[model samples]
Target: MPVIKLTSNTTLHYQEMNRGAAETIVLIHGMMSNLSVFYFNIAPMLAQRYHVVLYDLKGHGLSSKCTWGYHLQGMAADLIQLLDALHLRQVHVAGYSYGALIALQTAVSYPERIQQLVAIEAPDPFEQQTLARIDAYSKSALLEQIAAAGKAQGKPMSKRQLERNYNLYHFLLKQTTLQQDMLAEKDFMQQPGIDRLLHNTLLLYGTDSPCASTGKQLLRKIPNAQLAWLAGDHHIPVQQPFQVGSSINSFLQPRENRIHHFQPSATSIGVETPGWNLAM
Candidate 1:
């Protein structure tokens, strides 16, 4: 695993592909999820046209674990630091669920560092039901959650994978301040600068997702934002990776005379179609 030690004394595990491509796209996974969420499908698809970057957020996946800085502002700062460390001055950024919030925060805080923004299934942090669920987490519930997620992907997780999931859940829930940190950001959407976000933003949400409304809210708030509905619920990325990738690719594609320009030649895009595997 490739690791980069940040100024905060934390090491983050990350993967970079198609580094020679002109534009770079950074992928941030949701809370409790890792970079693998995009590693198998979306990342490879995007890598066809742009350099792709994915990293495990602090206390998630293979990254260093810490008890603080799980809030949106801190998380966004971490992303900015990562981009600086990689010498990437500006890049497109996409994030799913909690990661989506981080991406939005990053764009708000450091607009110059982000070219375009893609937010998928980002929930409003002030939602009572969502906060209730996070406050209810426990080891047993975490295991059941992992099992259900595996089933959703049409694959039963291996014992080893279950053990890893269990450990990760236990550490984040018991040893870290993740839940409280997130709860503190409840009014993030109501903050002053959200309406002024000037980036050409793409909001992707599932038609049936509870958070779909948030996408609409964001579209209304951000002057240059647009929303696209997908087929599945909150797990749209996992259920419809190709659709997700194609939408993002089209959105990020350069424009000519206000017309979308896509690389139609498969030979140039070099699309990868590997065997599908689920990682929770």
Candidate 2:
């Protein structure tokens, strides 16, 4: 229920844990999802080592709804506004899916305000499937897609969950500019300067995710990045929260030479160098 009024005249709901830490990590959720994605599992884990911040993005979760500013630039700007309002000059940040794109954009736009970077299951915006989904977005289509995905995993969603999801999906798809903003960002990954992100970066992707190729692309783009694969596909966080949370904790561990390796064969690129550590 805690919220902050952003400079944009919107109120963003956020939660903070492990106050008074020397450093902070901001968690951003993907399109249509909210801070709860991390509140239960990931935030608590990171709070053990660093102050953690999780907030609902504009028009999602408990955040005040808006019809504008869905582009990556606007999204990154919202993040900066949140940071400034909280008086945080810099933070470590992690985001999933489209949220990851916003994190990458933030790093590119506000390098001094960032420390380490973590990207989980960030899809390449240019993927045809990604565009198709945006162009074909509909509440019913989303329900069907979610149902199909749920069925594939042999887990049927309850009626209450479906209703909740539908309300959010309907607003984002049929009632806002989000889809257009998303389609406009199809070339985001191809933009210059993204290849030059200087933060010690962690790229976490699902071993079986179609977006693994994008993770590989990011690994190649960021000079000081390491890639680790988790067990699930796009839903890695929900499917393997403990593994995901622990991996993030180990990466953010302050002590030098402290590293943890994921299950064998799940990692693609991991190396140790002077003054930096890699999550294997």
Candidate 3:
């Protein structure tokens, strides 16, 4: 596994593909999920046309665990630091579920550092159901949920995988501030500047997903955002990876072509590299 140590002294696990492609696209997975969400199917499709980057968030996957910094702002800051470490000035960003919220926060805070944005199945932070679920999370509940998810997908959970997942859950729930940090941002979408976001954005939601309403809310807020409905629910990325990948690829292709034909203008967002510092 590849690791990059952030300025905060935390190390993150990441993977890259098609490094020499015309443009770079960064993929962020949702809460309790890792970059593996993209690594298998989506990244490969995008890599055919763009440089694709994927990383595990702090305390998730192979990344170093910490007790704080699970909030959106902090998560976005971590991403910025990672970009700085990788020498990438600006790149397209795509995120799912909680990761989508982080992507929105990043665009709002550092509009210049993002070329375009894709938000998939991002629930509204203010939703009561979202808060209630976090409040109810527990080690036993997590294991059962994972097992049920596996059964639904026709992949029965193995003892080894279950044990590994249990360990991860125990550490994150008992040792870290993830739940509290997430709860603190319950009103994030209603905050100032969210509705004013100006990036060319794509909002993807599953037709049957409860989060579809949130996608609609975002479409009304973001100036240039377009919403598209997929076939499944919150797990659309896993259930329909090829379709998701193709949609994003088509949405991003025109911009990538334009970059090759013209030099970025002085007015371009993030054209002037800005110094970044740890948000802690």
lDDT tens digits, residue span 97-152, model 1: 88999999999999999999999888899987765544342233455556787779
Which is the leading candidate under lDDT?
A: 1
Candidate 3 lDDT over 99-211, as tens digits, reads: 89999999999899999999988888787678554334323345555677787996666778778877877787778888788778888989877888888888877778778
Off by over 4 Å in 3: 131-155, 255-280
Candidate 2 lDDT over residue span 1-280, tens digit each = 8888877798999899997999999999877778888999888988988999999999989999998889999999999998998889999999987889889999999999999898888888787688554334334335555677788996666778779877887787889888788888888888886978898787888877778888888877888777877766777777677778877777776646564432223333343333354554
Cα distance off (Å), candidate 1, residue 109: 0.4
Please give the CA lDDT of all the candidate structures: 0.81, 0.80, 0.80
Error of 2 at 261 (Å): 10
In terms of TM-score, how similar is model 3 to the real structure? 0.84
Off by over 4 Å in 2: 131-158, 259-280
Backbone clashes, each candidate? 0, 0, 1
